[model samples]
Target: MSAPLLLILIAALAFLATHVLYEWLAKRLLIVSGAEYLVLGVLLGPQVTGLFPPSAVAAFEPILVLGIGWMGISAGTSLRLPRLVRIPSVTYRLSLVESLTTFALVAAGATSALAYGFQASYAAVMLPALTLGAIAVASTPAGLDVAFGLSARAGARRAAPVLRQIEVAHGMDAFVSIFAFGILIAAAHTQVPLMMRALTTTEWVVVTLGIGVVGGALFHLFLGSERSPDRLFISLGGAVILTSGAASYLQLSPTLAAFVMGIVLANSLRQPAPVDDVLRSGERPLYYVLLMLAGAAWAPGSNVVWWLVIMHYVVLRTIAKLWGTGIVTWINRAQAEVGLDWGRALMGQGRLTFALALDYSRRGLPYGDLIFTCAAVSVLFTEFFAARFVRSAVDPLLVPLEQLSMTLSATTEAVMESVTETMAQRFPALRKVDPDAKEHEHKGKR
Candidate 1:
């Protein structure tokens, strides 16, 4: 059997087992965004194993690239610009401030740490730090769902007045993170195509954006605002493949380009987006695939310098997250009641970090291993703290379950009573002609 093909069969089987194991692991945590898969991958990977070697794993890059590209597209589609325009301006300001500040603080600290403490060339120190900065900026958009159990339209949101602000920040923070990473690519390492060797950084950016627009147009033309569910999925897959393939050819970031395509579709498409439905339905397998790739690629750096950098990364990220978000929460405090420990609301890291790491760490860049390790470690730690941080956030807001149940019951009763009274007042004949209507409805429930 061919080496890469054999490796794939092994990973495919391991991935099935990982999915089952991950479901079991997820039960222990309040929120698990596939970090465990990375851990399992590490255990099964060449670093620890009887598993596929680095050469074989490297051969699998094409598949991982498309997966991460889809992630970028997925994030972009989440933004519906017309609707976001109506959210309070304060939210926009806060998301901007928080995202930028966190990026700046973490990037600066990480660079200083690596340049001074770790022994690496200029590129090695700068690149990973900057990647971490981008990873640090996006607070997971799902954080609210994890925190308030917002999945079912729970009442916790009514108690936490800052949810609108929290949500806007979460949704928009990825823009700042991804754009910063894209600029990093253009400025630091983007390759010169033979025909485009003289283009400046700004021109390079234009080229990448053009690629995204083209990809989106391809998707737009193919779907034409309508397609069956199955075809819609195929069309999106094809568009992402083409966009990512072009970016890969140019040594530009596929994630960034795919993101641009997603933005194009989200804003310009006039009908309900089947793109989202397809992505949602297919997201789990994507996560697992990336998880296996990330795990196999993960190699723990075995020196004090690397460990110190990891430690510095976690500390700096936490301080940056708290300090940046705290400052904004303070500013927003005067504007709204903001009833929870608002600083921690947006600290959870999600798939965007994984997506970026997958795009970067697989490229044989300087210290790519450490960057992937940091991304995994960062994700693992933040998810833990984010769930823990909910205690400080929701503890004060908690109501007794029985009491809440009674309150819901009373509210339902009061609403029904008001409706009946309004109907009787509007039509005196409703009571006279159908005197048993209310009684019959009540009795039917039994």
Candidate 2:
């Protein structure tokens, strides 16, 4: 194999090794210290250790887009209308209020800071802030996943309701963020005239949705009465890859287009099981690769202004999450307790934020580096603390029950073993006739 291919192979192997270590010894590390993998990418990347050259990284662009497209589809699955209808109305109300509040506050603050505080030009101020706002709206699913695990272990009765609310809120916020970012990206093109530009954003959205729906239909048709797992994987992957390529060609959001395709498959078809299975199986590896690439490309300069912008962005976004959640909880008294603590759940940032930041950097937007760096830093802080806080909050509720469950499990196992031993001693003839008699009898008894 050639040198570039060799480097790519090495990176893949490294990812596998790191993933194993992460899974076996440090599952929380995967969620909290995700940026460390990115740092590894940087070390192996062109700018640092030069294991992978810039040209090689550029060549891997298709894979990056594919990773992003997969993330979008995963996000899309959460927004199925049927699922949304089942969610509580209060969940919907709280999700909308909290997401919109964050978006509005971040946009307003970033725009003002960039435009007046930094004396940035028109595009520089408005575009970056708008993009940041969209990114700011995303809360990591990892936090909720961890929370669910804790709730399950603890058997907290109230945990399910809160988890459901967070899930809906995070899903809705991601959907809105992708849509808003698509429009912002369309509007960023200064070459287009005002009249045409007004139509451009709509046109892109239409084109994206159109591609997604068409792709979904094709996938559905291909998978008809097919049960082979390989075929299902290939078909779903092909549709997403094609849709992502088309979106990229049109300067639209591949993630959004793929998301639309997922939504289409989820809502428009009868048998979405195959598609869902394929997506779940592939999401993790793609997500890890995407983060590593983001780290490789990250190059935040040590400018005081940029640092200040990042700090302000984080502070304002946090305030928005807390304040908005508080207000919504106050209004909806039924779920007031859930609403109050919901903001803590929203602290983590994950795939969507990194995906958007990578897209911004790829687009070469003004102050893009600053925005991307801020996002990276934000993810590190939020993912680390959010996971800890959610675990701490929910674990306490579960400790007593968990201990009781463990004690009961231990007692039952010991009693069974003792009974088996007693039976073996009582019927030595049975053990002689069938050496495994006690084990088999124990299994039967259980």
Using TM-score as the measure, the top candidate is 1
TM-score list, all predictions: 0.82, 0.81
The sequence of per-residue lDDT tens digits that candidate 2 reaches over residues 1-446 is 24467457745854684567545433544244455667776786767877756666676788888888888888887567776787778778888888988999999888887887578776668889988999999888766554454344544543456656667778878988888887787676434354544456667578778887787778767775567789877777788889888887767788888888888778876666766777766776676677676666667688778877888789998898777787777888844336366676787887788888887878777888888888888887787566665665445434565688899999999999888889889988554465488789989999
Model 1 lDDT on a 0 to 1 scale: 0.72
Report residue 191 deviation for candidate 2 (angstroms).
6.5
Q: After superposition, how far is residue 372 of candidate 2 from its true place, in Å?
A: 1.3
Off by over 4 Å in 1: 1-29, 119-124, 146-161, 190-193, 334-336, 384-446
Model 2: residues >4 Å from true position, as ranges? Answer: 1-7, 14-19, 25-33, 122-124, 149-159, 190-199, 335-339, 393-446
